[model samples]
Target: MATGVMWSLCLLVCFLIGAARSESRALQKLDTGGGAENARAPPGPARALSAPSIAHDGRLVACSGKYLLGFEPNGSFAWIVPLGHMCNDSISPVFEGEQVYLVAEDKVIKVTPRNVHTAEPALEVFFSHNTTSGRSEEIIGLAISGSYSSLFLTIRNRGLFTFSLHGELQWSVGPALNLFDYHLGCKRNVSGCYFDSAPVLDQCEGALYISNTEGQLYSLYVDNRGIRWIQDLGSHGKVMTIAPGNSACLYIVFPRKSIVVGIDVSTGSISWTQNIGPISIEKNLPTVDSNGWMSIGSLDGTLYSISPDGDMRKFLAKTANDSVIHVGPILDCSGFSMYVAKTIVEGKLIQTVGDYTYVLAKKPSFILFTLLAPATGTVYWTGEYPGELSNLLSSSDLNDFTIDETVVLTLLSAAKTGISNTTQCYTRRQKIACICRQAKAKFVQADPGEPSYVLLLIFLLVVIVIQAVAILFCCIFWRKKRLQDNGLQKFLEKRRSLHSKRRILGKKILELEQRAAEDASSNEALGQLGEMVKVKEGVERKLYESYSLGRDEPSLEQQGSSLPLYHDKYRSHSFHSSQKESITIFNMLSDTSSSEDGTSSCSDDSESCSGTSSGEMELDESKSAEEAGPSNTANVEEGVQHELEKQHQHCSAP
Candidate 1:
């Protein structure tokens, strides 16, 4: 029983492995030209990293490692070209009139796609370059201008090279703009930048616009002018996509700056700049519609439609797990109409025209191609891609694409035919009614002020007026404050001047008081001397009068004779009194005059008078030494008193 159980388990494991392998095989198949319900997978070789490019003859060209494979519309291999080495990610085919040009590392090969039915296709070796001339470097971009009949090839660090249509080297420019350091042995960016996108052709201006990892946009004039201008757009990763506006402007996107700059094609002048979000990868280039609205994708699952004038309309796709949109958004056949899908899986807008839009997306983690209404973005039917589709291409951009009226008419007829099932019919009716309801909501006349737009406008006007008034008042206040500050400065200066004057006055008063004190001390000493001299003089005059009275009888007869002598003595006394009066007037005038003037003169007078008095006293002492001691002394004393009293009166009258 144990052996049987182990064998049963082993068989179950083998069956599960077989089922997974078969499912993978089924997923790898292709659908050919069968109907959507009865489509089957085609047997084709494995693919590589190369993406599909639409050829001039409506064929799909792709590079599988070292080989170039061309596929038919029904998803079958049409032709194959074996390259000498594995092609780099930058390798791409530039389709011209009859020949397709393919650039592999150091060489470019030319071949005609019409000759695929032959036993073995012949590819002409168009051109080859060595490592030094720059062509030998890894190729980063390829482009062709049929109008100018020239080819442009971009290689790492080797600027831009122009060639004839037949691959004849015209002129090569060095040190091409790249994301990495253009000079050798420079360590700036470890990732190493290069040209990652194809060059876009401006047929009208006869120039080619391309960008490099060095964050530069270059316009190469194919003629003798060479490089027209180089605009430093800032570094962008591998997703540098350039889109053209209607006639004048060329739009270049910078994913790192999350911006798109519009440059004039002829003059290379910047026209406008816009800020989009962090852009999605280079899965699709910027798509412009007839109305000049561009559709751009962001990594955050947001789709933005920008107008030529820099107006943007945005929509976000809701997803369950990882809503990062690695693929950029592509425009549909209709102008601004977009059919977007949102769910737990991936979705793509395959085709859209007017009301009918198709979405090749996954629902609930399962692949489903849904038909939706364009106006309302409502899903109508969900189906599969018939066979496992690795990639899908719209034929509108192909050179040989021709619209078939019959196919369009058939699709119209099928859409008009109603679904038979009740559940499906009900769902379809509900989706169709969605747009009508939206239209009714938009067009139905609203109540005059349901949104209070008038009130809002009035409120905005009032706010603006208030702001203006506040600004005016602020200006007036500022002006007044400035004037006030100026006046305050002047007032402070005046106050300082007044304070200085007060300080000077106080200093003068202090000096006057000091001098007055000195003058008071000197005057007190003079007053004391004058008092002593007056007392001595009064004593001498009284003694003289008493002596005269005692001798009156004896001199009665001599009195008449001495009368003249007395008259002379009286006259001398009057003269002395007059001199004293003059001295008194001078002293009074000096005291009323300035202290500086009074002190200067008074000092000289006081010294002179004191010296004279001391000399007179010395003379009197000598005279007393020569005469009768007491009598002579008395006479000398009396004479000295009289002289000292006169001198004291002159010096100390004030």
Candidate 2:
């Protein structure tokens, strides 16, 4: 009878194991593409823009034409304010502390953060000295210098002027009009010298540096109150921007030459000059951090981070051109956070923040969809029929789908189709259900969010009931055993041995169960890794095929093939390149071999260097270069067109 009971228990355990395995398999299969029936209607139509600047407190600030708009980190509008007047504004508005500063037609205006209604001019300064007694001078150029306390403005025809935060004039210097006469003499029919570019303020020396369209750079000593030094860059295009860091000056020129000239701040002597072609630099000025590394965008829609020593450590390509990235890239302490915005060919705005990027593309006439990160730059997630919105909604199904509340609200407000109302209702319901499920999961996973006194009372009651039952059973068993004393000592010993063996067996069974659980988890992780690899491989193959088909000229194809491949190998790869390079140097201090591969391999005992569980695989650099070799231009162009069509279809469907 005891043997039969054991066999029955073993059979039951086997049945349970089989059932669990079968259920897991069923779930895996169902996850492939089976959840479309419950999907909600598509979201509404709205135009998308990039929120590039984030305030110190994490508010996103952006410029849309002449308007300065502010939004929360989640893309909800905080406020919008228009500039006083628009005069072919090229640069994005700059913010310092609590005030926002803007420049237009040689006029400088400052406004307080509280005054964002309309275009309220708190203070304005004009600079144009070329006019006669009855005529108003055009402020040819304007720039803000120093901190918010000591503001400096420079104009083209006029010299330089300093003002306080309250708009009180501090001092005036220079009608430095003929400073670039020698440089401008190179070209016949040259107009008078103009200082259209903003002067960069040197906080350390309390001086200002301004350049002209004639390739002349001038340094003005604030204390000395005169020109320090002026250097002529021969026949170079207009000096677009200046970035001062590490006591060195970096100048960016436009049209054809994108030269990075480093100059000594104190002496105004050239330290090093590196000239990159026009395609290498965008109109947006490069941003420099506390470290010497500089990040600049290119006309070819790529972002490059160049080291102080002139090494290109990292580059991100395929960035759309939506808005001018005038504000330097933002860096967190971890070095893995930065943002960039680009305008697509369709006038859609796409912004990428940190490792995640979102593309807000236009759909048909009235609908817009914002494709989430990990979906961008790939055909599988982005190239499905009818586009990202329909694909995402259909795949997840409305029952478990999660929509960003701000996006949902914005879509609802902008909706024009009948599906808009239905989508709104479905999103609201899903959000409520998601909240409830999250709460329940939290309750089950850890201690319930209830009073400690209540939990203590329940625990005490359970313990009391258990003790009472055990005591009653002991009393009954002892009485019964006392009545039937047939070799009771031997029986007790035998029973004790059996219980010990059973306890040991139970412990072994538990150990096996734990091992099985771990194995199962590992298997699941491996499966996920495999899937990601396959997806990436497919995307890469497609990209290569497109490249192969798009080239018209062999030389151009060869040049394109020579371009570097940029992929983040880890989460920290998104950090500013400087920080990653610094960390690499720090790790290399202890190990000599680490510097060779640009990464420190971990030993078995070093927990800090443990391999990431996800195992993000990338194509070898050499392999990538080889695969990117020259292609036929006609084929490549056709391939690109096809890819675009595929992407369009993916983002547009229901």
Candidate 3:
């Protein structure tokens, strides 16, 4: 029987345990799934309208709406200025020294940086000139000389114009014969062309290579007015202009025919012509070193870096559709770095530097995000919107120390409150690795091991299992305890029945007591109010009697006085009266007795009468009560006393 009872208890416990488990599971599901949605980090800012361009000193500049501005790498706007309505072009502005040059519909204007480290303290217009004839000639290209002392401008239909840094016109040379006119048999190579590509000046030879829209390339003597040689690339797209380290050759792109051809500067003879597939070349090509190795892009959007021996290396690949239109010139600052501007769909700038790039997507939005790559196509660190960043002109001063300490610090701060708020979690880990990598790139450790990830998963599973087991045991124990107390359970059932009846009766009694207390409070308040009304009546009667007669008048005469006489007497009475005399008069009037009896009954009444008469003279010296009432003398006194009381209460309150 004992064994059977134990088994029965165990079974009952199991059943109860199962029920509790089911309920707990339901509660957990409701808590986790029904309460609220999971919170996610905000998205980064949108892209800028134009790609960021860098200045000589490494300051970044970009056109943001109608304003051109400079910003630090960490995305702080250093300076900004309005370009007015003249800012219509999508092309990034070019900068030199403290001035930036911009091209509009018909004019080219220069503006000072505004935030000059050393100040002559003026945003002087360095130059302004209109190059329009009725319809206005479009300014298609601009290139500053290596010294930045001379400007080379290309205007549609008007040819190339040379000017000094101060806008002085040096020469206006154009109307060159089209190569198509010369080569009648060669089919059209480029779709359309203007002198869009800037002239490449070879100082060693005193010669300039200028290509025109008619698929013609010209080699002109800088000192002499003569064309050295002309090559028909068969189509017009853009001429890839580059000065090779050999100093004797110039590389030009024949985009219409998808060819990259090299020409000898001395004789203008074709040194080498390499076919590089069908691609549209837009801006001037990017060259690494003086080795004649250059990277050029096609309209179809493939980027190729050609070797000195005319061999092509397909290093990076992106389609034209994936690329931005009217992208500024691709720049290769040194052998270690390459820069390109890509326009995002949202009309902001995305600057790719070497293997890393950042997308500056929106306004006041510090989505200055970064993308890093170790190899040709491998992406390294690629999350966290840093913040809004300006242009990056050069990577020369971006040392490991500066990058890790200052640059990283700035990025962390800019990201603290925006889309990057949660980035702090990752930054703490990344900062350690970044510092290690900065010390020695190869010293940087790899990510967490597979074993570590597995261990974390195991830890979570263990916790959940332990909690489930505890809950199951607890429910089992509770059910066993309930079953073991069967005899006591019967007694509890009987006690509960009696307790419930008592609870009902107790509730009814409490309701009746509450009603009785409310009635008693109402009666007490009414009684207090009735006493106040009786006191007011008594006081009024006394006032009437006092005002009816002078102090020296006989009681009989006072009693015989008319209502008008009483009112006049009240108006002429002394303003001040003794408290005792007033109280006695009030009692007498309330009793409706004789004034002699009232005065004789109170010893203080006689003294109060004499005191009141003396105080009357002093009262007359002050303004009348009517004037004092309007002046708020009573209200002022009450207000001061109330303020003091409030301060005392505040100080004393716990």
Candidate 4:
């Protein structure tokens, strides 16, 4: 359990350390955004004024002055048509099946390819119409019915005109009603009308929606060419563009008013008005999706999405270079199985003309070509051009331009050094796909190592810590348990058992051996040395010798002898031979006697020798006793008597 806990702790620490390191690596990657963007740089063309139109066959049709070019998705030209005259600047080409319509200054020509599937097919004029002849009657906008039967045209300073597909004039509405009269507090002079925006035909309701510069939005019932209703937008607040809604309502944007008004198409009455704050410049026409999301871009470089309920969201902030977002936001489908349901648009302007100062370099260029993401409004890839942008064209422009859903395109002005009034094309979806593939590859390569390294480090550290803690706990617990038992005492007993038993026993035996050896030596010494004297039975000898410090004196009391004196054979051992022996006691009682000689001589009969020696010794003793005091003489007399008795007993018995 302890080991497991330690391992867990170690793993945790490793994880933390790895996380910190990975965080650092991630920060390093943060600085690589610029490089990543460079790796997927957008494609560039000379210039373009507006989005390119997609034909029904998935081809992109772009206009460059009198030349109309059809391009494949790779930007390769599929076919080109020279119109012999300049194309209308404000309007785009209308495509229907294999047939395309070009609106020129004074004529409308329908061009068709012999074989659209061929690499470069033969093209010829299918029809032609002299729509107008007046010099000032230039066509500014054009629209075609969804059924490809009716064509709607908006001419400059002229009213709205409708015609059949066969070039027959159907009906015309002109001079929008005057609702702005300055004389009346409630009105202003907006009656000087001119049509600039394109006409919109609603097949569902059999109505056409058109607005003029004179501030009137006319909703005409198309069936009888009768007026449904007219809504005055006030003064120069002409509608810039109109976006039809999901229900009976439609949305219209006014450049001058900087607002979008929602109108009830059934009654031609405004349902709601949303104000867009003051911007750097004009805003593009709004685009509404099937969902109630309306996307619009401003010259201030911001893009906004407003819902039908009037709730607005600023989806994208101003771009990096402060370029005007001339092309309104678009929601492009990724078309990938994984992200099929996910709507992601791609690309936006890289550099922008900023802070206009009325100078050539500082002047606003109005050239923006980008693919936008619908989810976050992020630009994934960009297509570059040098021409002014007119407007954004998408598949939604199919009603008017006959664009196919498969061909996602944008058109821009291509005018450059010597080229004037030319245009270019961009495959927006292709560019977006390129960006996605490149970025994904790079990200996939970068992700694996850093995170794995972090996790491995974390696991190792956790294991190490857990193991250490477990070991430590085990050590402590064991020590405590040992102390709780008789560990100390047992340890001491074990130490004693480890001692040398043989050495201890040997010491004890050596001590006993030493004692025995001493005893044996003493016994031998005693056995070797005989007693000092050995006597044969029958007779025994007693020797006595007396000495005094002073010289001998003759006195009556000294004549008595107290102790017995006898000459001994060992008398030479008592003193040297030259020195005379001095006797303090006198007695003559001994079995053994010696004459006046230095050496001892033993005799079998001792009577004669003893009598002589006894007489001499007695005389010497009496003289020594006379020198002693009366009490000394008495003690001498008793000691002489006892000595004589001992000598008699020794001589008489064994």
- Point to the candidate with the largest lDDT: 1
lDDT for predicted candidate 2 compared with the true structure: 0.43
Model 1 agreement with the true structure over 480-539: per-residue lDDT tens digits:
432355564654454443343334334433454355346643442332233333333433
* Pairs that clash in candidate 1: 159-176, 178-214, 179-213, 179-214
What would the per-residue lDDT of candidate 3 be over residues 451-540, giving only the tens digit for each residue? 555666899999999999888865654454323455446535544433433343344334533553365223223222223222323333
Question: Candidate 2: where are CA atoms >4 Å away?
Answer: 1-53, 62-68, 81-84, 104-107, 115-148, 174-191, 247-255, 280-282, 300-302, 312-314, 317-337, 340-654
Which digits, one per residue and each the tens of the lDDT, describe model 2 over residues 244-342?
A: 544244434342454566666656666665654233233355655433456655443455565444555433343334322222333322121223332
Question: Total clashing residue pairs per candidate?
Answer: 4, 30, 20, 42
Ranking by TM-score: 1, 4, 3, 2
lDDT for model 4, please: 0.47
lDDT of 1 at 528: 29
Error at 557, model 1, angstroms: 99
Return the lDDT, model 3, position 65: 44
What lDDT does the true structure give each of the candidates? 0.49, 0.43, 0.44, 0.47
The candidate, 2 or 4, that scores higher on lDDT is 4
TM-score of 1: 0.45
**How high is the lDDT of residue 633 in model 1?**
34
What lDDT is obtained when candidate 1 is compared to the true structure? 0.49
Badly placed stretches (over 4 Å) of model 4 are 1-50, 115-135, 176-192, 277-283, 318-324, 331-654
**All candidates: TM-score:** 0.45, 0.39, 0.40, 0.43
Q: Which candidate ranks first by TM-score, i.e. highest?
A: 1
